[model samples]
Target: MTFFYNLWYSNSLQYKLISLMLYPFSLLWIIIDKLKFLMTKPYTSHLKIICVGNINVGGTGKTPISIFIFKILKKMGHNPIFLTSGYKGKISKPCIANNDVILFGDEAIILKNIGPTVVSKNKLEGVKYIENLNSKRKIYDIIVMDDGLQNYSIGKDLCFLTVDRKSLFGNEFCLPSGPLRQSLNSCKKNINKIILTGNRNFKKNHNILKKDILNSYIKVDKVSVKKKYLAFSGLGNNVKFFDTLKSANYNIALTKEFEDHHNYKENEIADLIKLANENNLKLITTEKDIVKIPKKYHLKINCLKMKIEFDKQDLISLKSLLKNKLND
Candidate 1:
């Protein structure tokens, strides 16, 4: 993963050369992806499905945006639930309110705390399980998929492709050669809207973004931590978390990085605590990371809660789009 970490972000000649060598593998990857689409028709769900996903290989603030959209749907008096193909988790079948982070992954655990949540290895099966769960008691109006734009296992009612303004499309190549999961043209054909997950002016960065597609902006919420702290995260883009802290004027004493979807061990936690004590720095991490840790350590660790806010016109447009979907 670290090799990928370097290959995707570094501008060094060596990395570029390696990417070139791996270019053929990327082509194979895209073929396999496309073949799956050709062979299998996506499952159609009865409920409206709003998919907040990305074509980029790493994080582009999908979770925060999903939560933001969920809040809006709830305010509109609709029973919305989160459905995801839970990554890095062991699940024989779809799980509902599955509190075991080790079994369902950290993201699902976090979502369950916020509202009703379901996870499956297959998103189509996940939707099926939700329908069964609803029949027993509670009913949900819509399903908000956390991340599955690339997985065409289920038909999506609405799709929002999240993009990072900075590393828009690394090297503008696909897979092992770059950060894209699929080609930009293929992505354009699939996604309905683009949600840029940073405050950078799209007008200025438009040359890099290039597409004349409909898009909106959402700034990552940077809550001011009152004290100096050490930050750590297992996000696909950990630098963003550290940068957010720095931007919020929070003094970051030390920073720790882990592979995306990293599962913490006792020794690692002990070592981190030891370092924090030695430096007299408070422990801080993203809310996503905190959910993966033991509940016992919750009091000792602080989470940087992420909130997503869109521009006024964009917010209105987003809401109207959802309402229209419901009406349909």
Candidate 2:
């Protein structure tokens, strides 16, 4: 998958040839997706729905941005609940999220830690479940959808399309041809704003101007610069995690990458621990990956906590936007 992802994002002659060969399938995907968008009548919930999603097929900091928005709404005195599909979880019906990563994926558990989270395969069902739960007391004021930009079944009051500044729509082609889930033109039509996450000095290459974009960068907690560590992660963009560690000046002795949302086996974890012990290095991983590991192994591994920090002006703008939506 990583190899294919690299090829999709590549600009070489081989990438061009593969993309040309896959163009027909990509075109079919685009048409089917567009038809779904046009046919569905979105359900308008009484609660405001703020969707944090991405056009890129892989990670673009959507979960982090969603958590950021949830915190902001909490500070503003608005009760916000999270709505997610539970991605790789076992359950199919709508239910309150729990710490069981096996039953409800890592993201659900992460969101549940912040506030109430509803995990449902159907977006509309999730929204309705929230509505029913709030009918008596009106506990939740808004729904912070983790990833549903392409899901048109539930209408959103505010939509944030998160983009990694470092990898802005690689190849600009859809699906098998490129990293994008849909074309930029189609995505822009549904989103309220583009949340650009990455380096502060990154230059813009897309049509979205600075004014229309909300800039953010990952804020990692300070760690010991002298301590040698063996870092590993199973994320959509493992390179980003490695880059973050490098930027933070961590002395990473070794690194391991896995497929996105990989469920670690006991043997795999044991090997990592053995390797770390032999090298006299501490084990480190992203918060998301840490949640998936068994509790007993936590003592042997250290989780790198990360949060999204918006630019000063963008923070102000986000507050104002949320306030206006609440009033409306």
Candidate 3:
């Protein structure tokens, strides 16, 4: 099911009924989570915890955004490390983010460039690893969590809720029935910041439920394309990928978008290369897609670098908030 279309059926009201019947599950889920928060000790000590998460389930570009903040922290001389429930890896302890995208997935590998990073499924275990770090050798002051908006075990001073600009509150249904991880109204109350990825919706009441914390709305555009290219990606919203190219006025000769978190095969790379050569087009893809691709085919590809374009005041507030967090 393509995340958004899973909620309702066209012919019958059956889907809606089923979803309504299961709505209690969302309430139950919310209650259980609140209880978890009430019971779990909020392991907080003035250390800055900035959560970059989303409203819908996939494709908000949290990893790149996290790296962007991490780089800024580095420039300002504050050590930053990335923490994640390390989606998909089986590593036990908070090992240095050393594995390649193929090994530990793209997000963890990407953060390694900025500073120390760890991917543990357990949040407490991951934080423990950070706590026991060598105090003498460049201790980390700020933690940029990639996907912890739902995690209450660790309290964050500021949480940036990232939503794929195209799919904000997909189908507006919670989990199994839709793309939303939780209720939309809950997000408005909990999040410290709302970051919109890609172009603005700009329609009447486009942001009906999210009017409150729309402080940071980031849009990604493609770099100027001086040449014709074959575009493809394994991202959640590949339409946004193609739209970015279109916005840049780049003519795409061919494009093949895969499922989210797709693992590339040697044959897949070869097929794309053959197609690109046949069409006389240069291959371009997103960074997340490039990581899953085999290294042998890397020389043949160039991943589109995503830059977050923000308004002036928003940028100032974000930097100020970050600065204060670091100083604290």
Find the candidate with the highest lDDT and give its number.
Answer: 2
- The TM-score of candidate 1 is 0.91
lDDT of 2 at 57: 77
Encode model 1's per-residue lDDT on 109-177: one tens digit a residue. 888887899988888888889878778777997999999888877888889888876667778788879
Show model 2 residue runs off by greater than 4 Å. Answer: 201-205, 208-211
Q: Ranking under TM-score, best-scoring first?
A: 2, 1, 3
The candidate with the higher lDDT, 2 or 3, is: 2
Write the residue-wise lDDT of candidate 2 on 1-328 in tens digits: 7667777777789768988898788888799889999999998888899999998877889999999999989998889999999888998899999889989998999999989999998989999999999988889989999999999888889998888887888877788777778767778788878889865545664745233888899878777788999999999988878888877888998999989998999999999999999999999998889989998999999998887898899899988988897788
Q: Tell me how far the alpha carbon of residue 176 in candidate 1 is from the true structure, in angstroms, after superposition.
A: 1.0
lDDT values for all models: 0.81, 0.87, 0.71
The lowest-lDDT stretch of 10 consecutive residues in candidate 2 is 202-211
| Tens-digit lDDT string for candidate 3 (10-119) | 22466676677777777777677667766877778445777888766667767767877788788888777798765655566566667666456676766765678887
- Candidate 3 Cα deviation (angstroms), residue 140: 1.2
TM-score per prediction, in order, is 0.91, 0.96, 0.84
Runs of candidate 3 exceeding 4 Å displacement: 1-28, 135-138, 200-205, 209-228, 325-328
Per-candidate alpha-carbon RMSD to the true structure? 2.6, 1.6, 3.4
Give every collision pair in model 3. none
